[model samples]
Target: MDTPSAAPHRMAPSGGCPHADNARLLARGAVVPVVLPGEIEGMAVVGHEALKEFLAHPDVAKNARHFTALREGRISEGWPLLTFATVQGMTTADGEDHRRLRSLVSRAFTARRVEELRPRIEELTVSLLDDLARAAASDGGVADLRHHFALPLPLGVICELLGVEDRHRDRLHRLSGHVVATDIGPQQVIAANRELVAVLGEIAQARAEHPGDDLTSALIAARDEEGDRLSQQELIGTLVLMIIAGHETTLNLITNAVRALCDHRDQLELVRSGHATWGDVVEETLRWDAPVSYFPFRYPVRDLTLGGTVVPKGTPVLAGYSAAGRDRAVHGSDADRFDVTRPRRGGAVRSLSLGHGAHYCLGAPLARLEAGIALEGLFTRFPDLELALPEGEPPRHASFVGNSVLTLPVRL
Candidate 1:
């Protein structure tokens, strides 16, 4: 294998999205590979095969190891993410521990299971829009949809799934954001994680004593069938993971979908026309301006070559799915534009934001439905709405995992 000798490239001047910088790298055919920081440590992964190699390697662990390597001056942190709850379970390593853990909760994500929740999702979407419409009417005919609807629908659904007290919904919502905030110091994330864990510990304890039909209850019930289905710690960790993952991914999807609709009026019109349809809106929203812009971090297990460069073992790598989605070699010019009617199986829609290989997001289907319902109702309910903020002034949050607009002011 060719050991790469060239210096790594700094991650594109991180704009709201990394697309422009990624376009520049794609033009050169080979991206600036991830190397040590003075070397380019994490987030600068080389060409595409590096993505496959890093994901599929047997020795590559998906926790903070990849990050530690980058901190140690290893470029290519090979995709190690800091707030990985799935990896804390089995989405990361091999062996019975991983297999046993993942199996306990996999059933709830089955295609049928997600389908079962569809009616409730539609009801929830409509209910939120009703509130948004009322807000618009009361507030000089405008409202910030992000605050009123985009954030709540998903948070509500996740609360239902986790069996969290509906009253705790707002608290969990605030806590999840603080836990994942990009502006905060490490201490903040630590405090958020600890507080969330403590809160979940209580919930799990309560569920253990008094189970219900939710995922938490289901896990407790599974104990009889699998015997060692979960420990108290495992239950708390998984709940926290599900809650945060549920909040993080779905909240961003709703926010980004609204932002995309405001950006692309024709697509907006198509959805308004109905021939374009809601499915079109959701897929378009996801592929157009992905909410989760990057993949969870990954670790390189062995010395490897990607796009002809050597990536040493144990380094962390940030695969920019947001960048990958618009790759010139892969998506062509259309990749830059949003096309809802496009087939879902091919092209840029297949971009790796929900990730690929072993760690593909388990909650993806539910998230899609939630966003589709939310956006479909949004335009159908308020086709007359107009943006209150100028296009240049749309708000944004700086996050390593999710980049989202903070508020989308609009008038109906």
Candidate 2:
């Protein structure tokens, strides 16, 4: 890709930057230095136009060959969760490999298949809301909505779709939390990953023994005309991917939506008063405070130029989705504001929340359906739902990849 002629700009040092404390500087419109763990140095693609171009580039591959420390012969050990994700899976593959894996999974995860889950999703949403209301009543009409609602809704939906037994939910949840935690030490992360993989392996083994109507079974039996199928490791990795990507991102989406609505009462009232649909609320929230803060570790197969900086081959590059969402150039001056009735650029809400191109999220349809149902159900059930905590005090999860409120204390 040709480099832009504009001089690269530096990102201001903000204590709140998610990845690193003194991370190298980069700007929304320019390519500049970025410091990542594992001694990986690279440039960040920030603004909407640059990010879109980076994601769609054919030569800027997603293969693990570019960023893995082991692949680069730099070191044997690196970030545990990142290493696990890059080792093998659809997220790290490119070209035919990605096509094959994505194709097989698509058979069971198609838009039609996701739409079929709406009734069940609504049922689950209502049940969780009922529990939240009861809990709030017992606790002086206050409850942590993140714990009771935002978190459980997606967990229930993904567990049902993946055929995970109820007995394993708590353990899986704990392990997944540790895996994504930014504050945890290396040993804890490694241990959590092992346990999570073991749980997924057991689930996969059970599915292989006796197939069912769930996605796991369908994935096991999925085959193409050439008889291509996911291998055993691929099966395990895909399940991990589905579980992590499927629920976690959606969980953050719901949490962020509720938080945004609470912060902007006028916008919440707009949705409540029927001026804006739940779909509008969800889309606006997605653009305003994207669920995934940063898409970590995109690397170039060869040295390449992005924006105005040269990104050497093998250096890790990150797509700052959170920063891009609020880029004033693309979304206008009020991009930082949360406006449900915010006009679309061209009758289309452009967002990278669900990703783009070949690696665009497979579970996006289900997430949208769940979030729409979830928001409608929560607000409709408790028309006067309000944040229990004062404004600007909600605690955030400290994770490099996830941007979510840790707890949403609310009064019904």
Candidate 3:
């Protein structure tokens, strides 16, 4: 009978290592107490089976309205994670609302639509790799691969997909960064949320005034059978969700995959020798180091016991995707080992990185497509690429939710 102490673990809002933190938490039990941003007490579902149960359980809901603390005036409106929880988009919605919201964007991400973007994705990959070569040539044979390559490929793709203008891209990226970063000050978090809403609102308004062949335009013009359409707040919220989630996750995926291959040269050899495919590399990296480490605030509809812990009704439960990825119970004793040749049973990759059930990531197919193209293009162009970090491992991104390095310097 694993039982955690009554006192909650003080999860750092930023700076501390996630791998170590998650390991210590998981060692205690599947479900453990945690202190979130704004001093809000919650439970972290960290074990393999426990997390799956949490995700699939109908009683564990995504709507923030169900959160007892927030509803009862205990939580602050400016809490760092409030934007994630209180958004009116599909991610925080449940049942009919989620289905309706998801359906609008689902069309743009259909198999045919994503396939149509392959040529463009390949073109962007080639262009970015060329730029990386030029940068390395001029900068003593080294360049920050993350900035020059990984960041821009998906960023450019997503910006084009949503019809974001050139002028808005930089500010949009910066504001989105602050929203996901747990390390920022409370005031900064509030300001970021406010500014993000303003910027997205502006874009949504522009799309309404003048339509284009883009998602924003389509969303603006969409209406269901009963003439139901997204409200102003919902439109902006959904755009915020799409814009941030679109590039950020894929950016980290590409960077993490490269870092993993660099660390495990043997795995690279497997790909080089045709023993493993780029798809294999992408799938393995997602399982080993998911881009999103911890997703916030899933509320329980009623009191329930999970992983031996009694969680009261309306308590916030975080989905511990990173910890669950490395669970030895699911992946066997060598779960930590990075192996590209590992057999994925029946061709389905076992990973909760993209999520599960109704709220599973809608951009998954596109993300996978972008990552596979980027990795193959990069390695083929620069097979001898190596990490150029002189001061040990590169600094990790200071966000509990985002798992990635701040910079990935490499020699071409």
lDDT of each: 0.66, 0.74, 0.86
Return whichever of 1 and 2 wins on TM-score.
2
- Which segments of candidate 3 are over 4 A away from where they belong? 1-6, 223-227, 345-349
- Better candidate number, 2 or 3, judged by TM-score: 3
- The digit string of per-residue lDDT tens for model 2 on 181-240 reads 655666776777778888998997787788788888877776322345677667777887
RMSD (Cα, Å) for all candidates, in order, is: 4.1, 3.7, 1.7
Q: Model 2: which ten-residue window has the lowest total lDDT? A: 19-28
Q: List model 1 lDDT by residue over 1-412, tens digit each.
A: 2234544455322225555666766654433454321333643442444555555556666655445544564432222234552325554435566567777777888899999999998898888888988998898888888888888888888888878887677777777777555445556666676777778777777777888888988876666456676666666667767887887787877777777777678877766676577776676666556676655456666765566555566556666656666655555667778766554434433545565666667888888888777776777777776678854866465554566777888887
**Alpha-carbon runs more than 4 Å astray in model 2:** 1-28, 75-78, 223-228, 343-349, 390-392
CA shift of 164, model 1, Å: 0.3
TM-score of each: 0.85, 0.90, 0.96
> What number of backbone clashes does candidate 2 have, counting pairs of residues 3 or more apart or in separate chains?
1
lDDT of 3 at 73: 92
Best by lDDT: 3
RMSD of 3: 1.7
**Lowest-scoring 10 consecutive residues by lDDT in candidate 3?**
223-232
